[model samples]
Target: MAISITQFASDSNLLNTPLWDKQSEILEEFWAGNYAIAVWALGRRSGKTLMSAIVATYCATMLADEYKRHLRPGEKFYIISVANTIDQAKIALQGVKDLINGSPILKPLIVRETTDTLELRNGAVFRALTASSRSGRGMACPLLIFDELAHAVDTEAGNAAGSSLYQALSPSVAQFGKIGKILLLSSPWIQSGIFWDLYKQAASGNFAHMQVVQAPTWEVNTTISAEFLEQEKARDPELFKVEYGAQFTGNIAAFIDNQLVDAAINSDRGLLPPLNKFNGTYYLALDPAKGGRDAYTACIVHYDGELVVVDQFHQFAPTWGDGKKTQVAVSLVEDWILEQHKAYGFASVVLDQYNSSSTIQRLSGRVKIRELTWTASSKTEAYSKLRELFNGGSIELYPHPKANGQIKNLTVTYRPNGTWGVSGGTGAAVDDYPSALAGAVLMATNRINKQQIIPAKSYRTW
Candidate 1:
């Protein structure tokens, strides 16, 4: 008799309790099909990691002998599990370890274990890796799993990296023919990427062998109450549509182009020397931290006839303590600004009004302060100007890791108020870096326009 996934779970010590109804359905459907790829668009807390662990574990142990039959003498095969980051990949691998640890029947099969790999005595190996096309290359993988695949995009280009990664690994996966299996699962994101493409294809029956499942949190977990979902929807309806409703958000999109940002970065350059090293007037911009949750960030830039060059970027720690028990002193942050002003002699300083009144007062007589009270309209204008500079090749960025990261992760969302909001996306905790950079660019652009230092055609859209 052929082994069923449901029967394997029930008979083995894999789970302390019986599988959830929806989980069993998902497993049964995939197991019974001749699918080379199974794409799951599930809601948050819907047990994606757990499901991946179960499938990978089963193939690595019970089906190891059968899977290795086609391999040449002494050829190695891998059951690879990947996630957006190393930390996330570790969580998936830990899920497999937890199952093995709890099961007396499966525990003895482990011949060796490492940080990112588990090797069974039957010569089958399970490895966890960070999501990258390079990482997937040159491996003979029979089983491959992608957790939170929707977030695996090309950070600089603001496009999906999933297609490139899939292409790189698909040849190896195809080598196994009927034995090869690829599992991709994530909470639904924007309507782009390989996940969305595969989902639509499966729905249209374009591929007769592919399996696709769309499961909401309540359906899969059953423990999430309606009251909790109600509160979440009330908190953020648009976000709720994507997170709980398991729907794609058409309003969400990447703010900047990858090649544009890449070309703007001066890779060989470090932070430019202060005002004395250059002849152009300098502009400084600050984005103050709030509630001890964000970094206090600042940027310094100047227009040098042809381009707006970012000379300096600074991000002060928001708090210091073993358990975030102490907030950073505002006075210390002010002192650092004062110190920078002395070196740059900024022609003018621009800052958002949020949590910045005290800083303005301290530097009142010491510097020329231009207070910007951000409104929906004003932010759109400022951020739009920054994007224009990037597209026109009118900006040059010094090497700043935080600034680069925030720029790459920025998202543009259409608000209900009939305006566009530029903010951070998943895994981007704060956008202070880009905020300050945009402010600095806006100030420099305005000053250059007022002075008529460059031809109108030179910076018309820049």
Candidate 2:
């Protein structure tokens, strides 16, 4: 017996009791198939995972009878969710599983479970697949959900995630033609990628196949704390606007986009030995806290003429003794640099003359160190080199959340004098970590490039 979704929704208790107002409207728009592709740019934790699960399960179970009728003999209908990580993908899967077990009407159709999919007796399947370019291969899915399309666009899921999934699954929908559905929803990230493009297209009212919904966190989930958002706005106003205010803050202004940073992550302990342990030509960069809650930073980088790989990075904020704590922090930073130099065979050490305190003078006796002044021009140059490394895809970054977090939060700011420099973007604790890494990379490359001035065979001087 075929049952329409409206009948199922009314009787089967498909959603939670007392649904939020907008959720009802979204659900209503969803089942009506008002748009073949829907883009929801929602604030964080706006119940997107639950909504995604409801749609997937409904298409897989309640609508199974009618949708199955469209399938040719031996063809199976699929409801797929592709997310950045397995855990992310499984969230929606768990949502579907929970709903099915709770539903008296749909629970009977779940016949079996495989490693990656749940099977229904009505010839429908629900799959939770990690966003890998290869995940969509050989699937005939009519409904697809891309959770955190922004994360997918920036990380390992780049090739197989977000819009990329369309190439693989679009063919599967050839049987259903225009009836197949794709819902891409996420908290805004960079201003680039498929989600942003779809939103702009929908805004223009030019794209007939797509519709966009942009809502602040509170608009979608009224239960969210206004107090918390207010506190966060007080803490970092720019970030709050982008994250919770439903604003498409320009990602172009970021010095390092998440995609570049995600691609540069090189932490696989077994595959590639860490820089702290590996024996290689290493360069060390150190930054000192001037005052206040500023952090002291150290970053180590190695260059293979072309690629700059950061092997180690460390940073910490000084306990606020103000002037006294800064001296202690500098001493600690220098000692740590000495330890690293002894262990890793650091070839050169780079430090800003302005922030080096007496660390440079103290280390002069034991190790070779170069002191460079940090003006707007020097800072601009270092940042440019860092961008080149990322642009050329030649930077192997040590995977540290502290450093990566700073990297992602770094924004490029142009001064009145037309010089480009980097400042920590919204939600960053401090910009010291990124500055240290930039200094290390600049020194590593400069050391090698200067060597090129003297022909390799003619003179062994750099």
Candidate 3:
């Protein structure tokens, strides 16, 4: 007995021949299970596109055949592949074409076109589409593959055409006996977006998900040496993580040392000591800007043995009218602090007093609000102090997921004048959050009584 093309391809010999890594195993399992959705997250140059194309090609040819055999002729079986742009779509399809060309048996069944589609002899089609919301309209597809879905724009006019396209294709897939399969592949970009939501859902076991593969630069190929990665880390650690770590860290280029920031994050345990026991008091730091693209960022910190950032609030305002919205924001901050104080009693609130005098004055009467002066020289000093605290493990962050998003936006840089400036990137402005945190540490650890409280307990004792 001779095996068919589909059978041969499905055999372990053929499937495992092309360097079957962990991602391939997951994809094969997902396909075999007829999963409704599968997300593949790989770092740069992990051959994600190639793997995606292979899956799409298999669905277009082998899976479509299986689907048609279980139904009548003239039934629709479509493989719709999309990417952030037309060029990216082309690149994805190119990998499909390469896969087909490399396989002697599969090459004969594929009809390649310059536009980047593979029309199988079995009447199944593999068409490359752009991520434009318009692209998915009025088309029925059984299989949907979205490459780099994170970068797709979600228009404000309530017109998510790209997303809508996928929704539209659902019925067509459901018409078949099997559940529709949607494969979303991308590197991390923005922290909060449609893609992030989908990824989270998949990760949380909300869906029948396969695996999330993180192919860092080191894992991609030998060309990306550790020395090169170290160089990139030296240049800007946040950028290196974003570029190579497959971390969707929003622009944090302006902070002093991103490596230090990354190191500060506690991956093992998110717990911190009780706020009241560590510091006798707590303070809220505010960096105010007139309502514009940048809004005021407020950070609330508690001083324990070190400075601990308890919470952060940020809002954007594009005009003076928006700035007027600060009252509502201020009220929210007050409520937050009151809640925190109730949880762990705090001493007072410290704020940058220049622009927010009125706001400060308004809050001071209710809760203790002290104004902290920001000198040009102190900016560097404060940033250095923060680094020291972070490295020394004196600071603890709230384990809220939002804190990760905030941290991703922080960057560090040294000024030409031998000073350092920590800035926020990716639609974030003002160093208020870090500043407040640093202020809390300063106030807590600063020797006011000329005495230090040493912990009687040690790690060995614990």
Highest lDDT against the true fold, candidate = 1
Clashes of 2: 2
What candidate 3 gets wrong by more than 4 Å, as runs, is: 1-17, 69-72, 154-165, 209-224, 248-254, 258-462
The digit string of per-residue lDDT tens for model 3 on 1-462 reads: 143333444555333225334544566566566567776666666666866776776666656656676455775566778876679888888877776767766677765556856777777777787766454544556677888766665445222443555565545556555545678777666555556667777788756643444556566554557787776665445545655687764422445344455665656655444444544455545555544334555555554443455544434333235443432345555566566556645555555655656656566555655565666655555565565555555566654454444455566643211134566554534444555565554444443334321211111110
Clashes of each: 2, 2, 14
Error (Å) of candidate 2 at residue 42 is 0.7
What local lDDT does model 3 show for residue 321? 53
Worst 10 residues of 2 by lDDT: 452-461
Q: What would the TM-scores of all predictions be?
A: 0.59, 0.57, 0.51
Best by TM-score: 1
lDDT of 3 at 445: 48
Each model's lDDT:
0.77, 0.70, 0.57
lDDT of 3 at 51: 69
TM-score for predicted model 2 compared with the true structure: 0.57
The predictions' CA RMSDs to the true structure, in order, are 17.7, 16.6, 16.5
| Residue range 118-153, candidate 1, lDDT tens digits | 887777878888776366676788898988877775
Worst 10 residues of 3 by lDDT: 453-462
The superposed Cα distance between candidate 3 and the true structure at residue 97, in angstroms, equals 1.5
